[model samples]
Target: MASERAAAAGVLRRPRLVIFDFDGVIADSETIALEELAAEMTARGAETSYEQARALFLGMSTARHMAYISEKSGRPCAPDFPDVWHGRLFSRYSTELVAVTGVHRTLNLLDRLGIDYCIASGGSVERIRFALDCLGLASRFEGRAFSAEMVARGKPAPDLFLHAAAARSTSPHECLVVEDAPSGVMAAVAAEMPCAAFLGGSHLDPIRTRHRETLIQAGATACVGDHAELQVMIEAR
Candidate 1:
């Protein structure tokens, strides 16, 4: 295995693969997702911020989130929550879900460096691919992209990222996960992989400090603001 520096310097490394969370890490799907979700909840008189929505749904499968909410609220989530939420999200992001500010640049750098990577998202495969396509990242990933929908469980359970690592033919310790939600950080940690939390639109502050700590406690080596820090961490490794 080449050292981390070697890998970042464009040399092949045994830990060649990086698994990314799509909604908040790569594409700005979280913003779009929360926007639509908030609006839906608002129409139902349950308006909440992205932070609230994220707190409620991040790292959980959309279907599972709805179910949890239904169980907790003791009221059925709209029978149409899945299709409506999914449809609203996709419609709002019909052509706007883009890679984060530094994501494309980092991806280009990784591509130039010959580092292999994949998307391991909590989103369904169809939703993940839809956003990736909007950002023109679909073809770039091709067969490397995977979703929680492929696994028996989602984040905080390790199934999704574990599936991704298996597909990439890498060991958990050899992989680095870039995520934004607590559930994702937990997922990576549960898989025995290093992870970094990205805090962007989640607007978590006082809680973000605690959130970062929780991530570290759960298994993330660090928490950062964006992919730029991630690039630096990978290079420094």
Candidate 2:
């Protein structure tokens, strides 16, 4: 496991491949999605708040999130819930989504440094592609985006990250994962890859310190305040 002390020391090995998480790490879309989920639950008579929704569902898979909603509301989610929810979410994403602050600069840095990078997100492939397209990053990540749907298990498990590494033909030790959630940090650790916990997402603005602590405890090798800090970390020897 990665130690917080080591992470705080600000020393990290430069990696050949950088694996980025999509929603909160690359695209500034978590706040929109969480707010929408809270509103949707409230309209369904569950009375959920944005904070509550974020705490409960931030890193969960779609099926797991629906199951959680059903358990919390004491009613099963409609069978078509995923489809309907995604449609609504994508509609909103088209108008409101933007890339995370400093993400483009960070990617440009990676390009100049000659590091290979790809997206390995918990979101569906379709969602990932749509978001990249919306952010005008589709061409940059072409043929390099991976989704959890392709693996047997999602975050908190090593499967998806490992699958991504194998597909990219990169060794786990040669990969660095950039994530904004504890589950993703854990997944990276379990995959034996170093992870930088990103705290720049708007959804984390109100709880950045707490989330940073949580992610460090979850085995992140470092905590980055934003993509600028991330670039510094990546540039470190």
Candidate 3:
């Protein structure tokens, strides 16, 4: 079909590796994340919504989130809030941050195809490990996961993804970044890596509206919502 050919053209001609973002892409944790953040914000008299939280807080570090909310609400978030919030969020995340739909199967497919891949996330190294361990995916990624905190700068900076690519021993141009946030897309662009934005979080529409062209203009060859379609694209490449 014409559509099939078009889809094929959208994929990389030959990719040496793939890198994935965590929070909204491979884990079903955004809704619960918003709830937790809202709870924390309520104590500070700030409002929250899945959309607002995703747009402003998700993919950001706790310190960044605290600073963001502080600026938004004009109130100082409790200094201990980060530790407490992290504890509460991790407890819930441990219980609820299951693998996203089809993620496990897709990872397996990639493994079967002998494709090199890694998780490049904005979360801390410990947090990334916790989620991977909870999902029993730790074994699949030995020396392959790199946290943003490990780099000089986080998302929108190109450090994390670039580090992951370096660990995989691949050129930036040959690596494909699978992301779910505008920041991640920006990071990919800054790294000069090809990217694909997967619309899966609460801010999906807004992120699409705001960054669809930015992503393409930033060097994303394609944007898609379905993981199956992404799998097909990768396989074709």
Spell out the clash pairs found in candidate 3: none
lDDT of each: 0.74, 0.85, 0.75
Candidate 2 residue-wise lDDT, 24-115, digit = tens = 98999998888877877776657789999888777667777677778878998877766766787899989999999999999999999999
Model 1: residues >4 Å from true position, as ranges? Answer: 1-14, 41-49, 73-79, 200-211
Candidate 3: tens digits of C-alpha lDDT, residues 1-237: 337334634656557788988877787666776678778876676777666776676566666777777876888877887666667779987777777777877788788887788889877787778778888888888788888778888888888888888888998998888887677888988999888776655435455556555555555667766577677777777
What is the clash count for each candidate, in the order shown? 0, 0, 0
Per-residue CA lDDT of candidate 1, range 1-237, in tens?
125323433421235778888877777667678767767765655556667786777767876767655765567778777677889888878866666778877787778767789999888888887887888888888998898889998888999898998998888887878887878888987898877667654444347667666655666666666667667666654
The reply for model 2, stretches above 4 Å from the true place, is 1-9, 44-47
Better of 1 and 2 by lDDT: 2
Give the best candidate by lDDT: 2
- What is residue 82's positional error in candidate 3, in angstroms? 2.8
Give the Å error, residue 43, model 3: 2.2
Error of 2 at 53 (Å): 1.6
Ranking by TM-score: 2, 3, 1
